[model samples]
Target: MGGSATRSAAREVILTLVVAAILIAAMPLLIGTYTLTVLVIYGMLGLSLGLIWGFGGILCFGQAAFFGLGAYIYAISAVNIGESTLPMILAVLLTAGFALLLGAMMFYGRLTDVYLGVITLVVTLILFKFINSTAGPQYVIGEARLGGFNGIPGFQTLNVPGDPGAYIWGDALYYVCAVALVIVFLLVTWLLRSSFGRIAVGIRENETRMALMGYDVAARKTVLFAIGAAIAGLAGALFASWAEIVTPTLFSLGQSAEIIIWCIVGGLGTRLGPVVGAAGLAYLEFVLGQQSMIDNTLIMGLVLVIFVLFLPRGLVPAIASLWQGSVGAFGRRRPVRRMRRARHG
Candidate 1:
């Protein structure tokens, strides 16, 4: 059984790799520029959720606050400095700072789990409402208006240093987003395999025992919350650059809920699951939303219900089932000797 399980897991991993490669390889030719941009955005946001919910066990509801802040920061900084890269750096720093401060307040106070969740959610909603209500109150950032509810538009393209030729910044933007996603994913995966990450999992699995084991549980959670928020902020900046628009909608409760749904629907703990979930839902929304049926909303709700009700573990686990199901799909197959020989030899 152990060998079979290992073999099954190996096959599933291989399959996922192949699928990712195929999708990426086909992306340039199969999808239009707009679709490509959207997919990249989905992957980026999903990666953020993947890091926070999947590994850190921080079910933050205010990630959108960082996200929107990053966007506003990037937009504001770019307008002020007239440079794209500078805004990115500024956005990252400012967003990380915000996350750090917020985490210190909440996590230091020993608010965690459900209470932590509520605090984050409330904070995020407050941000959303504030931004929505104050889009155009106008602080002069180097002679540029924030444009408030109007947000910021017509931002400068990224300037790669020392490059000679003209570049389609849009395509470069997609690649930038993709490359960033890959790097962030690798980093998170490595972190999870580290002692610190293991401690996080220990907190996730059993925080009290970990605390008794002399771990600073609150500090750990706080650190993770900040780190996850930083990632989320980066994602928001990317989204702003890719879409060339910043909106209060970016910080809304809907945005927060969607990240949670994506993580949950994608097999929350796994690295790739949330990314896949984000991409899958985006695809579904794009395709299904084209119709204006009376029951369209109802159908979508039902689908969500069905997935949660019948397949609790989510899409990744369902995908892992493919190997087992394939074996069963053969019905009452060969003898053990034959099966072993076919599988190994």
Candidate 2:
């Protein structure tokens, strides 16, 4: 029995490995640079949520603030310095800084799940209000309009030495984003399996016991929050490069809700599930939106309602279970039919 079980598990693993390899090998041929960029952004967004809500056990509703902050940080800095990489680095740092401040203040004050969620919402709304309302003055950053509601356009694209930018590229940015998505996925997966990750899991299970066990709960939460924000900031930079536009929408309540939906609709606690869910949903939205025959909002509403009702854990496991059930049902039917034939005979 043990040997059979082991062999069955190995077969499952091999099947999954083969499928993944084939899909990856054909991705460049199957998907264009634009589509690949969108997938990369989706993966990054998934990783961001999986870190905070999934692993850290923090239901952060303020991620869009960091997302917007990162984009603005990159855009504003690029306008100032006329470079992309520096702006991205600054965006990460600035996002981490704001996250540390917000997390320290809220977590240290003994805010629990619901209240913590509210605080995050408030933070993002505050950011949205400030940015959306404060644009339009002649505020100049040494000659560039902060651009305000109308974001700056005609920006210089990112370029590396001995290499071309995305605009002047042979799928370089797509490959860069693909590399980043894989690296971030592996890094976050490793983090979730580490000692720090265990402590996070402990906190998620029982913060009181973990705090009593000599762990600085607030500190750990704050640092993890910062880390999550930094990752989200990096995602925002990728998004900016992909869309070539940044807006106050990034800090809007809707934006925050989208991240929450992505996290919840994707299976929480598992890293890759969310990545797949985010990308799958995004791809569906994109494809449907392009078709004149379908109303995407209706499609999204139906998907959200059905998923929330039937598969609260989201699409990944839901689809997996459906596939398994189909196979098992057929097998069971074969056995039942043979039994019926024997009884009739």
Candidate 3:
């Protein structure tokens, strides 16, 4: 049983890597930079939620808070520093630090699951309102003006590392984002199969049991939460570069809700599931946005309801189930056919 399980896992990993390679190789030739860049950003956002909610069993409703925090940090820092290299690093670090502090407060306080979600939502709202109110010139952080509701614009965009002057845009930016997504995906996959990951999942499954086993449940949860935030921060930084602007909308309730929807729709728990979900739905939304007659929000809401009612495990899991069922049936039939042939002979 152990050997079989190992083989199955190995096969799954190889298949995931191969598929990722093929997609990366084909995306440059098939899609424009704008479309590809947006997909990459969405993919990272989905991954952030998928890691926290899917694996850590922490449903963070304020994931957008970290995302916005990262964007604002990057924008402000880049504007002040006149280069993106340091600002990008600061964005990720600050976001992770904030998550670590927030998670520590929540986990150590022994907040219940519902309360955790509520607190995250409230935190996001507070940030949104505060940032939205910062329309005055006094809200400036060095060279970067917090354009209040209008958002901070004209910040330095991401440039090549070391050179600082040469910008990565267009097709080059697409490749960078694509490569980043692939790396993040592979890292998350490896972590999920690691001992730390198993322990985290164990805590999610039965916190009491994991606690009794001498695991520091709160600490583990905090680390996972921070990791998720850092991933979201990376996404946010990329988004700011892609759009050449950062807005409080990044911290809006709507964005938070959408992130949750992506994770749920894509089939959470697996590494690639959220990416698949985020990209598929985002593209759908984009297409829907083009049609003057169709209300995109209504369509999305309906799709969510349909998925929850009929396909709770989500698209990836549903397809996996069908594949397994087909394989099982085929195997069973082969044995019966072999037995019949032997008897007839």
Give me the candidate number with maximum lDDT: 3
Cα lDDT tens digits for candidate 3, 1-345: 979857866786688678877987787677676888888889998999998888888999999999999999999999999888999899999999999999999999988689999999999999999999999989988877898899999988999988778999888888788888888877787677678887877887789999999999999999999999999999999999999999999999989988988988988666667888999899899888989897899998998899889987678766755775678954445444322221111
RMSD of each: 6.4, 8.2, 6.5
| Shift of residue 149 alpha carbon in model 2, Å | 1.8
Of the pair 1 and 2, which is ahead by lDDT? 2
Order by lDDT, highest first:
3, 2, 1
| Candidate 3, backbone clash total | 0
Q: Write the per-residue lDDT of candidate 2 for residues 48-68, one digit (tens) a residue.
A: 877888777899988888888
TM-score of each: 0.83, 0.83, 0.92
Best by TM-score: 3
Q: Which ten residues in a row have the lowest lDDT in candidate 1?
A: 336-345
Question: Candidate 1, which segments miss by more than 4 Å at Cα?
Answer: 1-22, 135-137, 162-168, 294-300, 322-345
Instruction: Give the TM-score (vs. native) of candidate 3.
Output: 0.92
Report the C-alpha displacement of residue 66, candidate 3, in angstroms.
Answer: 1.1
User: What lDDT is reached at residue 116 by model 3?
Assistant: 99
- Model 2: lDDT equals 0.74
